[model samples]
Target chain A: MIEVKDLRFVYPNGVEALRGVSLKIEDGEFVAIMGQNGAGKTTLVKHFNGLLKPTKGDVYVDGVNTKDVSVATLARKVGYVFQNPDHQLFCESVEQEVAFALKNFGFDQETIEKRVSWALQLLGLTQYRQVSPFMLSGGERKRVALASVLAWDPKVVILDEPTIGQDYAQKEKLRQFIMQLRTQKKTVVIVTHDVEFVAECQPRIILMKNGKIVADGSAKEILTNPEVLLQASVIPPQITQTFHYLKDIGLPTNVIDVYEARETILEFLGETKK
Target chain B: MRFMVARESVEVIKTEKLTFTYAGRNEPSIRDVGLSIEKGEFVILTGPSGCGKTTLCRCFNGLIPHFYQGKLEGEVIVAGLKVNEHPTYELACHVGLVFQNPENQLFALSVEKDVAFGLENLGLPREEIRKRVDWAMKVAGVYELKDRAPYELSGGQQQRVAIASVLAMRPEVIVLDEPTSFLDPLGAKRIFEDIYKLNQKLGITVILVEHRLDLAAKYATRVIVMNDGRVLLDGDPREVLSLEKTRLLGVGIPKATRLYQLLKNDGIPLKSGKVPLTPEEAAEAIKEAFKSD
Candidate 1:
């Protein structure tokens, strides 16, 4: 659904955030971009939605060049959730916040209301429909941001650090939401350093370093590689590290998620009957 | 040579029935909360978002009433002065409040100017401001970026400059509200380490309001969990983290502790004296649980 050819981006002040980057995201593919701060992860994804046009090469969504598409036009197919919810939140009420996108898209009032309610109920914001968003907590506000984008039901869903401030339970809920998006055959792209969440989601991992795509592989391949993660300035999930550490101690282990780590260890111990 | 000893356990902040409501808001943001912290304690203030954790931190540095128009209904004492009685400028010298958004705090063209902003505002001599600014930048590991514009820097770099600006003031206590929310995991860990070092080297009381418990929990001596604008659980990290209430509140428990709980519930308890906080500790405990026959 997304294609980029030799894309390079530079800010107005002349900081080249992306350099000669090429990526192709197929339809219904879930990809996680991992990198350290200032690693060009955010700058690259902004091109997916025409937020930042390439300074050098071309980015295409469904065969249409991003340079030809306005941000508003791209918003119809690509819904981008920013890292900070405050940057996107301006509405007074939670319900209005979710409906803003639909209203702007010129949907009928009935469709707008139906989609808004579906998004709100899905994200568990139904109870706070009338409450001002400013009164909600940071996590709830983030959910509102997600709901706003999800209500539009764009073909591609891009979330920037969706799990940043979330707790385990909240992260689990988001994980389920991502899975639902996948089952619906939507392309999902997440720019985040949340190793555990990435491991849980099991997305195709695209690792970046110094404005370049250094490694792209499965979560099992990328997250389990301590060297690759270290080069990207990311720490592998503790459980991944824990199991990898035991590789020399004669336990067959390449587990990434905690559940897999637990079951693997338990099975190994059970087989030994120790 | 004469020897002097620092006062042990001196109360740096104390609150009595503190309550605040934002202007035009019917309900109080934070209600009837009472708490205290010592001069050198590292406290983690966390809870579900909008549970008034930020409001409580604002009370520590005189922002609740001074900057934010609000109804203050309780006493808040910080560094031996009543928070309500002091102006924000006066309190800024005693308490450094680092906000969540680095962009909000970093407005100076260059990083050095941003770091120097606080010291210069205190009307310190140019020489002293330069010295303090340099020292603060070094402590925050932002000295190299002194000439870089704040707008050009990355989220993590901007956050470091924000911290350096606050550190330059040499405040007795630093209150950072979700300072690393915009950063990645590695970036967040690095910032937490800097805050931890500041607490250790400078003896500055650190009140970090964060939800990344898996990263920040180990550094905090105390974790204050709030829900519904009230203090729900406050105590040692190990003790407070193990409670079911904290988990039920949707607060992310550290992965190691989650594994420990999982094993313990399955009748395969880790043989540790206390709950493991890191994966290594969890590994050791599991190793013990499955020792060779």
Candidate 2:
């Protein structure tokens, strides 16, 4: 759905964030952009929605070049959720926050209400419909932010650090929500530092370093490669590390998730007994 | 050998029947929270987000009523000084507070100027400010970045500069409220390592309000778990972490402890005594289990 060709982005101060990077993301694919701070992951993703224009190269969404489209019009095609929820949320009530983008896109009143309600239901935020956005907790505010973007019904959703500052349950909820988005065939691109979350989600992992794509493959391929993960300042998940150690000890198990690792170990023991 | 020292000094901070209610809110943020911390001890205050951990830390630095107007029912004393009675500037000298967002605390153009801002505000002599600025930067391990701008540094480096700025005052107690929340894992590790060095090497009394239990479990001498504006658990890390109740407390444990628990629950003949703090320790335990089997 998205294609980039030799993309290069430099800030006005002459700091190049994306340096001749290129990648192709298929339609309805869930891709995660992983990198450390200052690795230019955020700068690269901002170009997808036209929040940033590449200084030297081109970014195309569904064969439409971003350089020729207005940011607001592009935003309707590619929704972006920032790292801080407070940066995007300015409405008083939860319902109004979700409907803000729909109204801005000039949707009719009835269609806007329907989209807002559907978005709230999808994120499980309907119960907080009338509550003030400022009074909600951090996790709840993040859900509201997601709903705000999702209400616009964009083809692709880009989330920046969606799981930061969240507890285990909340993170799990977000994980499942992202999976659901993938199953619904809406392209999802997440820029994050949480390696464990990315591992659990098992999306197409794109390792970006110094404003360039270093590795692009399945999560198992990218996560198991210690050299790539280390260069990105990302750690392999504990389960992945365990399997790596077990494999070193002559156990041939390619387990990436915890449940699979448990089953593989149990099966290995059974085979030894046989 | 790590020796457990007997409590030698009176409580530097003691809360008696403390209750704090934010303006226009009927429910109190902190409710009858009675706790005490001895001198020269490291304590971790943690809970789910918006569970009054930040409010409790604010009370320590006289930001409760001095900087914020609120309904306070109980007294909070720091180093025998009542927080409510003193000005925030006076309390700031003795109780240095480092907030979660490093960008909010920094205002100077350069790193050195930011580190020396607090000391200069106290009207210390130029020589003393210079000495303290150098010492604090060295202690916080940001001396190399002295000429850099605060905005130019990474989140972790910026936080270290913020800590250095607070440490320049040489406060008796230093309270950091989720200082590593915004940082990446490596940056988070750097900040906590700095805190550990400060507490161990310099003997600074440290109180951290954090959510990352894996980092806090390794260094904090005491862990204070808060829920619903009250202290839920407080004691040594090993004792508090071993409780089954902690798993249900909604805060996560260290990765090592979780791995150990998973192995033990699977009928692995592992010593289920004290929880390991690092992955290296967990690996050792696994090796020991395999050897015995």
TM-score of chain A of each: 0.97, 0.96
**Inter-residue clash pairs, candidate 1:** A137-B49, A137-B50
Put down candidate 1 lDDT per residue, A143-221, tens digits, no spaces. 9999999999999999998986676678889999899999999999999977777878899999998899999999998
Evaluated at residue A178, the lDDT of candidate 1 is: 91
Clashing pairs in 2: none
**TM-score, every prediction:** 0.94, 0.92
Q: How does the DockQ of candidate 2 come out?
A: 0.43
Worst 10 residues of 1 chain B by lDDT: B284-293
Which TM-score value belongs to model 2? 0.92
- Among these predictions, the greatest lDDT belongs to 1
Candidate 2 lDDT, A1-274, residue by residue in tens: 9999999999998888889999999999999998777889989989999999989989999999999999998998899999889899999899999988888899999999999999999877898899898877666798899999998888899999887667665677788988888888999999987766776789999998888888999998988888888887776766666555555445543456655555555565556556
- In model 2, which runs have C-alpha deviations exceeding 4 angstroms? A117-132, A241-256, A269-274, B1-7
Q: Residue B274: error of model 2 in Å?
A: 1.5
Name model 1 segments beyond 4 Å from true. Answer: B1-7
DockQ of each candidate, alpha-carbon based: 0.59, 0.43
